[model samples]
Target: MPHTLIRIDDLEDPRIAAYRDIRERDLVGRKGRFVAEGKVVLNVLFSTARFAAESVLLRENRVPGMTHIIDRIPPEVPVYVASGDLMDAIAGFPMHRGVLAIGLRSEEEPAEALLARLPSEALVVALAGISDHDNMGAIFRNAAAFGADAVIMDRTCCDPLYRKAIRVSVGAALKVPFARGGSADAVADTLEAQGFQVLALSPSGKQAIEDVERAPRCALLLGAEGPGLPEALLSRLPSVRIPMRADFDSLNVATAAAIALHRLWRPPTL
Candidate 1:
């Protein structure tokens, strides 16, 4: 079904209010809503059943190129178009990409519930204290690239649904299944309870990543750079380190995750 396009000429229109001053509102909570920007992210927003499009705001000229994506929007969702000047004013920025949408996230699912749904053979990413949006996004992108079944984040981690994070992930954040909430230890506990062999990544880990054996159900535990995983948590789990140059002992959390995920990921047999 085709999406109805609404024309807006005025800046004060209440219908586009959620899109106003997007840069300022990016940090402030959007309740259950989030801004999905760029053509690529919009594609995932429309393609995924994990999220629903509440509405879309596009530059009038960009509409000609967006029919394929627009067609994916449900008939009830509105697609609004405006002039470049009006879009710039509404977003408080250049609005160069000329694409944006309000995506609604459903109720948060429990970590236990999300883990329970994974297959008997699964690879999952568990994150702790990952406060940087860029790293969070890159990690999700890597997870999608490496075929990890899901991503589980602890309470201290930043929101993957953040506009910058989602944009950085190139929509992988929307495509990959994830669950948030709980302490780092609590997250580890849940993964273990679901039959996952929790492997913590840190510079001082007892074993090198290449030497570790793969488990049928595995969760790669990663933490923020510099501080890395909690020392206590590291002590409790099977820790693995990515070997580097003689003096260098660390890798960025996201890069480390990619290496570990690649090392552990086995291509599914036909």
Candidate 2:
């Protein structure tokens, strides 16, 4: 079965309503749907079994260039094409990438369920109060680059599925498995219950990141910038800090995560 390229001529066409005013829709939420922009992200959307592509919207000129990617779409999903002008109109902005897709997130997996599914030997990135989208995306990208088993986010963290975050991650957000709801302490407790050695990342951490030994199952816990992990939480966990200049005591949460993940990551054994 082949994917059908549906021509979208009417600006008000209901079929593409999901792609309308994308930036605004991003804020209000998409009702379980997320927009994947650009060729790279769309590739993940079509290739991954974790999410379903409800439909795709491409600038008319982009169709020829995107045939390779479009061919991978499931036969049942519609691929929409429109002129660049109409594409901009539909999106409520200039869409330079000319590639757009709406993907459906199935009911989100709970943090406990996600943790239970990981292999006995795993490395996880646990985040707290990280509400910035770019940082959220970057952390996920780092998680993917470093081969972390999964990411668990406290309730205060921003949505990794947000369009801009997904874009910043260069599609890593789609590839990384993550669970999004729980308090900082609750998330840590959940990771600990799963036999994970949870290490908090803080500037004042007693141990240097390089000095800490990786456990069979380890989790690097990070908190938001400025006001890092809570004092009480920091006091409870064995913590590690990245060595830095004397005056500088902090790194962006994502930067800290990348550094910690790189140091802690081990390649999977065959």
Candidate 3:
């Protein structure tokens, strides 16, 4: 079946509301939906079963190159096309990428439910107070790359589904399975209850990450950039640090997560 393409000459058209004022709208909130930008992110949205697309909006010139992706989308989903100037006006910015999508994630499940479903041997990432979207996205990308089973985010963490995060992750945000909510200790308690060796990543950690032994299931807990993990939380869990220069205390949260995940990651054997 051929995909329907609608030309957008009217800025007031309700169907393309998802694409309007994209910069502000992305931060404002999408209720349950998220906007996916660029060809790479759009391809992940179309290919992944984790989310469903409400519609696709793109510059007219992008349509011809996107036929392969268009055919894969359900016939009922509308594809809106607009001229470059119109797209820029609608998006409230210079729309260089020329592609956008509206997608909805299913209702979020509790962290406990996500922990309960983990396999016997798995790698999980638990985040606390990570309010930066770019860091959150980079961590998710690292999680996916290192074969983590799931990601658990605490209440204070920023949304991984945020547009910049999604774009920065290069769509890995959509690919990874994650659950967010609950207090920092509550999240840690849940992981501990699930038999995960909850290891907090901290600069003051007594153990070096390279020397720490891998457990059947492990959760790497990380906090925000400046403060690192809170002392209250750090005291409760076994902590591990990436060995660094005497003068350097820490790496960025995302870079640290990538390094730790690589050390703890257990890739499945076929």
Candidate 2 has an lDDT of 0.91
Q: Compared to the true structure, candidate 1 yields what TM-score?
A: 0.97
Q: Write the per-residue lDDT of candidate 1 for residues 117-179, one digit (tens) a residue.
A: 899999999999999999999999999999999999999999999999999999999999999
Off-target runs (Cα >4 Å) in candidate 3 are none
Could you tell me which residue pairs clash in candidate 1? none
lDDT of 2 by residue, 1-270 (tens): 556889999999999999999999998999999989999889887787878889999998888888889889988888899999999999999999999999888888999999999998899999999888999988988999999888899999889999999998888889889997578999999999999999999989999999999898999999999899999889999999999998967578888999998899988679
Query: Residue by residue across 2-103, what tens digits does model 3's lDDT show?
Result: 887988999888988888898998767888899888898888888888999999998998898998888888776788999999999999999998999999
- Collision pairs in model 2: none
Between the candidate structures 1 and 3, which one is better when assessed by TM-score? Answer: 1
In order of lDDT, best first, we have 1, 2, 3
Error of 2 at 10 (Å): 1.2
Model 3 residue pairs with clashes: none
TM-scores, in order shown? Answer: 0.97, 0.97, 0.96
Candidate 1 error regions (>4 Å): none
